[model samples]
Target chain A: MMRNMQRPMDAMGRDELRLWIQQLQFTMRDLALYLDTHPEDANAHRCYLDALQRWKQALAAYKERFGIQFQEQVCDHTDWSAWVSTPWPWEKGEN
Target chain B: MWQYQKALQYPVKIKQPNAKLAKMVITQLGGPDGELGASMRYLNQRYTMPLRELSGLLTDIGTEELSHMEIVSALVYQLTKGLTPEQLEAQGFAPYFVDHTTGIYPVAASGVPFSAEVFQSTGDAIADLHEDLGAEQKARKTYDNILRLADDPDVRDVIRFLRAREIVHYQRFGEGMRLLQDKLAASSPWPKNPYAFNPSFDHECWKHKGRKEK
Candidate 1:
């Protein structure tokens, strides 16, 4: 029998890693917006919790394997730092 | 209704603490025209606004102000770190260190704690927007003061980004003002509008119905 072919989470590269973070941010923002209208939406509250978990896990995996760009706790600098010299959307005129 | 989570918005990496400058930043955090004020002003003003778009803008901007509060708090955190007794005596952080050791307390850099007076909610859109625009300008001035006082380029970059946000917010509120003006005039009664040459007072002109309608 043929099995479902799912791309593994570990298969994601740097750009994919960045996209994962973006997805987490989008979901978080959506939850925030949704809650404004449906403050008591239990399903929505559940989704918020789920997204937070996904973000935490994904960030941990990304930092362990490829290293972090967006977070401070995952930095490599002897001093506190981020690899900001690399291009990001704000500098690329995407903002 | 938004929940507060600590923001790691953009990674702010400061090499060393400058206790003096951190003190000033805290003043607005706790003082009038501080982030607490800015955030509350917009959030509270949102409920009374007749237009949905303006209300959305207020909520979005108010949310951003929360992030701004986090950013300044981070700066204060970084600035107040690693103060030994010797450094405290030398840099004039003795009083502050005595009170709070690296705990993020909202205070004016002048040492005042965060307070409700930092913001106003007048319950009128025009009055609120007027206050909002002025608030942005005041925030920009605070950034200017930060630039003048701060020697660290890292700190300056954050201050600059924050200053630019105040301008962007000002532009947005200005756009909001234009929209509100249009709505007010459109809501005005058409026939009595002496200023119908300019369509602004169309709806509002009717309210002075103290004069009998022609």
Candidate 2:
């Protein structure tokens, strides 16, 4: 089940997209921590894979609409410094 | 060898500047048992961990500590962003203000600079794992104290998230120690005392001359 119920990223504002992405990213991080200790847990593994796929989708949409989030996300010369030019996470008032 | 994540492990957005609160929160950045020491201790000790799983735990936990460090620093930055000299003096932040001028610096709540003397890396898996467990508790207590003093709901929310992480880390470290104990008990020459030798450094005795040398 897709965890995010927000409107499509294309229709959402910058802050809304960022917030949705943050939620999906957190789900992946939490699952990653669980799988580290219980690698053989089938249910947890399935949850992790599902979360991972959703996280990637949200992240791709975010970068496509706004800018790169991780350094490795940069794909072309036009995408250079996408990580740096993007707003720092701690910055308030805007995403 | 670690990659930087452009975002915080969680969000920290403090709308109102509160130098008084920032002064207390900054301790977690550089104080004894702070995230800086926590990260350094685990990452350094992992180099000598006997088991691959133990080392993996250290790597992941240590990396998480780095992210926590950033969150703490961001909290301090947001809290102290725009304070006048008068407000700083009134809030008892003049001392920190005179030195850093709203810039974030790592120092204990009592103003002691961060020191390697605060943490240990004995290179023994059991010892190191025990230390990691203790470190997590100390961190948790600090967050608890912060939660008690924090008035802003937003600040409290972030503090709660960080505090929960410490408990989780404590659980993971405890499991790592248990794994080490089981392996030692089953494989050690001195089966009775699971810690007969330091597994990370004891190469000769570790060959486990199965029947005992007696």
Candidate 3:
């Protein structure tokens, strides 16, 4: 389950890469709810940690390729236009 | 304290723009049992929870509902994108289009604006958790109604995801209720009368310091 993080980012298309990140996020979120009630479940805790690590890596790679998703991610030299110029999520073909 | 994540929790890539469908789907974003109410109900109710675990559960579920709100907004936005005034009117979206003009507004399908009156934060542990459980089922039923009417696969796919989440949340809230009940039972003078006092307001039950006995 963890090996996907080792796969080369370039191997997947933009949409595929985004989908991968979304899947990792879903895993983390679902695990989070389970852990909230069953905080003593060690197996779920491990899975949450694994998902968190993969989600972070995949998100970083996505930002590097597709520009920043959040304003704080703006680089010192990078213009703010880069953030506004990208298509909003609701726009067709942007997701 | 929350930072924005400029992405949908789930991907919504609706290919067709249908004003008619947008009208109905917008309800989940603003209707009485909508995502907006779901988020507010849990977040507001968390403050007075007697158990730490219950508070944590409310916070998590509340945050997820915010994400769900974004998803529903994206669906409405995508559905209404690029629709002409004539097209909108033909599809009975004119009432919304007149006031908001394709801009997303929180309103029921009947064009009633969103209101806080839809939910409650009674500050009682058992009551609030029961409300949450019912709220989840109501939201789930709304999604089911949407699925029954929605013909577009793209729209139904996203609706199904949101509906499934409601069921999961319902299950979690039920567990949270059990947790609260167990704590109350342990501390109650009479286990059968746990409802005799609100655990949230009766801080003495939990033995918090800095309070003078009356």
Best by DockQ: 3
Better of 2 and 3 by DockQ: 3
For residues B129-212, write the lDDT of model 3, one tens digit per residue: 989999999999999999999999999999999999999999999988888776666666556667778889976455433333
DockQ of 3: 0.65
- Second chain only: TM-score per model? 0.84, 0.94, 0.94
Q: Which has the higher TM-score value, candidate number 1 or candidate number 3?
A: 3
Models, CA RMSD each:
11.3, 3.0, 3.8
DockQ per candidate, 2 decimals: 0.06, 0.47, 0.65
Model 1 Cα lDDT, one tens digit per residue, B88-202: 6677777777777767777776777777777777656777778899999998998898788888887898788788878878887887777665555545555334433322213
Candidate 1 residue B38 C-alpha distance from true site, Å = 0.9
Question: Candidate 3: which stretches are off by over 4 Å?
Answer: A1-8, A64-66, A70-81, B204-214
* Best model per TM-score: 3
Taken over the whole model, the C-alpha lDDT of each candidate is: 0.67, 0.81, 0.85
Label model 2 with its docking quality class: acceptable
lDDT of 3: 0.85
lDDT of 3 at B170: 95
Candidates in order, TM-scores: namely 0.65, 0.90, 0.91
Interface RMSD of 1: 9.5
Better of 1 and 2 by DockQ: 2
Instruction: Report model 1's chain A TM-score.
Output: 0.72
